[model samples]
Target: MRSLSLLLFTFLCTCVPAQTIAQTVDTLMEYTAPSATITAYGNEPGIGTAAPVALLQQEELTRYDKSSLLSGLNRVPGVRFEERATASYRIAIRGASLRAPFGVRNTQVYWNGIPFGEPGGDVPLSFLDAVNTDRVQIIKGPSGGFYGPGTAGTLLMNTESIHQEGLFKLAPRYANASITTGSYGFLRADATIQRTKEAGTYNQFRIGYQRTDGYRDHSGMDRLTLQYTSTFRGQKSGAKTALHALYTKLDYELPGGLNPEQYADNPRQARPGSADKNASIHYHNLLLGLTDERSLGSWKLESALYTTGFYFDHPFNFDYKREANLGAGGRFALRRLLRDDLALALGVESRLQYRNGQNFTNPDGTRPGDLNFSDEIFSRQGLAFGQLTYTPGAWDFHLGLSSSQLDYSVDRTFSAEGVTGETEFTANRPVSVRLAAGRTFDFGYLYLSRTDGFSPPTLDEFRTNEGGLNVDLDPEIGTNYEVGFSTSVAGKFFPSISVFHFALDEAITSFSDDRGTQLFRNAGKTRQQGIELAASWRAISTTDKAIGLSFYTSYTYYNFTYLELERGGTDFSGQDIPGAVPHTLNVEVGIDLRNGLRLDLFHNYTDAIPLNDANDVFADSFHLLRAKLSYPFKSFNVFVAGANLLDQRMSFGNDLNPQFGRRYFQPAPGRNWQVGMSWTAAPKR
Candidate 1:
């Protein structure tokens, strides 16, 4: 069967027409549209919007190695993506990662306009394949006034199945397939099929699979995913409907955090007792979504509904646990043009989640020995938002207001004491407000904005691994002030800069107990300020009819400190925040030879990071270099890439405020390389 499949793929690659390949490549290379008004948030261009918005188009996404999304995301200033190990991911916008021990927190994420964040405040970013994504938009700072209550920021992600008007629209049917293999026993394969008709109907289906023998012991991973999307436009009603469905099965081993001695002796070795304990995670998830849009005279309405279910099985040195989670949510919005220069919008969003969890004593980590605890958890969140926009001449004005509430309960059906009743907690409802104004001049655009919002504790934070709840945790309230400017030099060099200051009361942070159980608490207050700069230059364009060259760079500088905090008889006031880097710089260069050959190079530099609250321990700064080269002929394209070319030993993610002095580092992979080929078939227009 394997031989037959390989033969079929070879035939498809060799039998396709050559004339259409250039057209397909050109269509995929188009990059300027996503940064335009099509971006979320008021459907306005970046210069016209008062917020600090960063956009990554498909062309930028494809410029790096396709194994992970971290490379592309880190290119944006004030944003960070951490890879603790293969298939393990953590995302932070600005300095929000302080509250996230694992996974994604504080930030709100949307996939294809559907809220990807669950009621528990976790976004499953590891389940997504970066190569399958078409675009990304990050709105920095508190965006609760329009995107719901979030103190970190907001993220909007659109996958390839959404159809960005180039591939599917050019033909009735299109197909593409690719396979990749790399170091550390890495392998990946994927295929996509799309169909579109002139009657305004479209459908797309995609499947992907990946596996890897990770760099460290007990860090292997395997994943398989399936996705489908469909769209239809009513001919008479003048309405549009879209459906999206996705399923994923993922399994990964956990090597655990290593102390300094263990890391220096053997960087590739798993933590002590980890291998004997069978530390690993098994995950399965399914998500479905539906969206509809219609026009009523002078008003427009948009609505979306989504549901998700997931099963998680984890084994660790401390215990073995299993959980099943279910969630559902909906969003609705109405937009109207009150006048030619004025607009009004109103929206509502809500989410609900339920979980059944069980924990047991792990004699060998794989099997449960004794029932430790079992609990049922429920959470709900809701928000109502409104916005008004007025544009006169070359000036733009925006006012946004929102109110949000959250509640959760824990029912300990079976515990050490057995049959514990439920305990509920209701968070303080807050009213969020945002005001902004922008002006467009002949040479550039300038804007100033202020926002106020709050973030509450997540379900995981409230319920600790010790099978108990923490009821004293409170929400973190913050205010942000920002100023930004963007301009173009000679229609080729694009540059943008933003500076902001954020003050928070009762900031949330994490700590671990002596038993290795993670917990959360509110710090007194924090003051964070930062500067971000991004620029792009098209040195040579295809329109010039010669070799095309482009360069892009982003830089970030942060001065984050604790304004007031007291822990364990120590005053930590005026200390730098742990887990937040002070400086970062990223640069990339893309070269396209008109003759079907391409080259891309990327460089990243991160400053030393504080690892503990005392500010005595710090992770060393590091530099990384990567490059990729590809060539296309007829209908097939082949590529080769390398990562971490410097072979530097660095801790990409740190376990902050560890109870044990030395157990604070999660070393990243050393050096790696990959090669792959893809075949695409598109109809002639």
Candidate 2:
């Protein structure tokens, strides 16, 4: 009890002053300028648009590291992070599956305006470092129109750019560094450097490294990343370029399922004589972008063009895989403010992507073996969208519409010792539309309506010779609906609530045939509904003593039932879909002390999920607790964190990836602690 009191006291002292000062200054600076200045081509509200839709500013992101940033973004309801290992994570939104070996399906991840996914629409989260991001946006449901056609969800991450304001003014400007250690052998370090000037030109660089000796045996990882952004401005146009690169080497022990006896006695023990696997992945991405703004009569024209390239390589278990992607896109927008009450924006965009890759398998456990399979694919898309806003008295109304078309083609070949053949090239075309509406009232309250479309399968679903497998899959479609309200109370408290439902059709499923080879099939209907609530407040405010509190919680209910199934040439009904957790809860709270000190608490709970169609294997419910404390000074920062405070063991999947067991596959680590410090000195002004 004494320790708890002290912890709370410390938190209150750190945050109060900052909160009070910010509020006072913001209130005093609420005066409006002479006229409303608006830019076209900007899709969403800018820095200080609506009270609820305001973009998070730069200061809000400074204290966060990669993992915390990802975890703290719970604003998007029904999004969950699947911990693959210490440094590897998969983001699952609204019950979307993350088990595809080739890559993640149904989700699209983007950095800046460029895609961070494989050409075939697989997003690998291991390549991104959240610590370096300036802002993160999550678009839920089947809103793939902004990216491509197949994704059901989109994660957009924006990194710091060189053209930002207030970067180069201070002599020997400000800088900071952070280090963290937790469960397993988790260790992470992040640092940033920036240079800004009054000429509208700036340069920023971020570097990060992470390593972990995983909870399970034979699971370990090392990851390194570097990113840079630079911008140059001319009279009416600007050129912005970003470079990002990452290298990850993972030596993970695979945990095959255990029999009944082994499970009951010791779940964390490793199976005997299992093969040790080493996997290495290299990712490189570069983006070059240009933006131009000009005026024609009373209207403004905004345009942007971007080109990006990504490459990947993996070598493991006598197999070598490699892939490369090149993509380019351009967007043009027209914007105008009509009278004093209306604003309009219209934009058109087109993107083209090409991918080439090959997978080779051999008995020698080395490269240059027999070419087992190879694939080459091409994808192209175009989109047109428009948004209009009208402000009349206390009511603010917004409307948006977008349409898209996608075309994809794939060529595949499979070669075995005796059987060698090429599958006929396949092509697919998918189209989609989206609509959204929202209204803001006088009391800082808002209501919204939205619908987004998602495209299903492509050539990868039908090519038999593509990867030594046969897939006769059909496209799956998704429709999502959402409603929400948000407002702040007492000028010091902020809160929001939202509810959403998603419906999926022709969902993809995989099953093994009599020959033991797996095949893909389109399954039945699945639905997910959930609610989210979050609040933040300044608990204590004063000149000499400061304190603050923030809390966020969310709950989700997901249900999946097989509408149709075929078993051994016979129909089987009334089976629960595997890997669907019915319920999930997440909560977080944090406090700041006056003397540059901070403390945070977090919790997560997930209900049981089915292992297989028969419900034979079940992953039980589990809870996790974590805490962190940090102190900052003029030149350096130090922090400590503890994870799995309760030593809870939970598994996400039934047999495929059973978490922390008596054997070597323990997914979560036992209680552990770590502390580290770093110092930074910025360049002279």
Candidate 3:
């Protein structure tokens, strides 16, 4: 706690005063952020299998008022969220979280050019506030070769840019503030300011405070966040540079899981031992980065350097831990237009991460004590990839190749007198290829692709060394083939559909033992196949009320199962892979009137999921209904929002496979509501 405060004080002292904006700046490769153009691909677009991408901007993002990040991500296809409590989030892309009961694994997240993941391959969302984001992008599929290994996919979060449109001389400087209160005793307050003093330069700052007394016992959460962004551009060279820094303090209580009987008895009650033990986590996260973009005679160059670290103290039922995570990385890319019909892109990236931590002994209902072990973990990754695209008339052909090397090591510096510790080291080099062909016409386009993926076990999966390191586990490797097409009718209706099949070797599986220790094992073989569809129609439109009567929806069918497996004297072959949901659907209806009023409605449904490898236990199917309304005034905005309007009894967090049903169900919140107002000011030139 002291360390976090000291760091916070030091950072606040270094903030430079900002001025007013002079011009508008543009962002590339971000499809829906203020502009959606076919050429938005820019240079950094996805390189393989044309991973389905989704982007949310403006109202689609701000309506939730940062209450729950999942509320926004749920609108995207092939995405799911496991929420154990407010701000404690686990995001799954195509069932990538099958092995993780909590936290984000097998997926990578980035914000303002900095990675949210640690050296151990785990990314926790507790340190982030949704209000700090301006746009969100998701890439669905294993992009291991291009984005460090993760079988699931990638999430890209972008901050509000100081150089965006609507911030020119007319609005050279501005400040905004908002306060909100909601059901379950949720409260939030925030302030933001932006300025630009010189041409092609600007600065932005934001700070927020939020607290929530959860719907269940012992599930309260609170957070504080501060962020700063600046941009500097060279007038003569036309070089653009951006800098970002962020710090956040967060701590949340853990109302442990419940067994089936306990769940039916009382869904809002905390586990007996959890309340007395004060099970919770206190975390402090810090991030910094610098990015540059420039243009050569016939080529463009882009680069970024970033550093991130976090300090956390966790006290749980079976163990206690204090962790210091540090990581650094850089990326460089060059793209050239060799000819009118040809384009080429080459990029290289490298990352290094290290974690120093200590583990202690904790009794069933007491605080941590007795330093039992001290360990250090190290991870390094490097990738080089290239892509070529040819365009002639309505036909486009693309090919890409990437090679990556990932290394991991864990060393136990000290251990209790009676316990022996073991050190482990390993490495994997994976190569991937992407091939796709597409054709576009006035009405639509068609595309097909093939790609490969690879992801290794995370640090949590290795911590159960039982004295030494768990060395029997291998990485999950797979190949995917897919085909898709999209079309539009009369410029008012749009639809897209895709189908994919992926086969894996040495798939990772999760399990917990009687001693309360989590473990990971390799399943012999597995396969995942799914179909996804998305569509939008504009029933009413005019110059002033464009897309006023618009409706959009997305649906998915996932059949992920084990092809063969034998572990712990159990033959679990041919069973539906536990934790991987089989079906999901989302629907939304948005209406905008010329009178400056907006109303949006949404619905989501999820099919039952297997809770065990034997496929005997299950979590029933569930659906959610949500709505939001907003009205704009001359200087401020008024809004109201509600989630899970049906107030159904369901559980979003599931204990993948438990030994004695200790904590297999963590209930979801019932219906909730919030109302807020926003005010903005910007003096004209």
* Best model number under lDDT: 1
Model 3 regions more than 4 Å off: 1-33, 37-49, 162-165, 363-367, 417-422, 464-468, 542-547
Task: Give the TM-scores of the predictions, in the order they appear.
Answer: 0.94, 0.79, 0.91
Local accuracy by lDDT, each model: 0.82, 0.54, 0.74
Q: Which segments of candidate 1 are over 4 A away from where they belong?
A: 1-35, 44-47, 160-170, 683-685
| Sort by TM-score, top down from the best | 1, 3, 2
**Top candidate when judged by TM-score against the true structure:** 1
lDDT of 3 at 58: 46
lDDT of 2 at 74: 37
Candidate 3, residue 306: Cα displacement in angstroms equals 1.3
Residue 176 error, candidate 1, Å: 1.2
**Per-residue C-alpha lDDT of model 3 across residues 254-311, encoded as one tens digit per residue:** 8877888888899899877777777788888888889888998888987888998889
Q: Model 2 — which ten-residue stretch has the worst lDDT?
A: 31-40
lDDT (tens digit, per residue) of candidate 2 on 212-303: 66666555666555566665555354433333433322233333334446655665544432333234455665556665566777777766
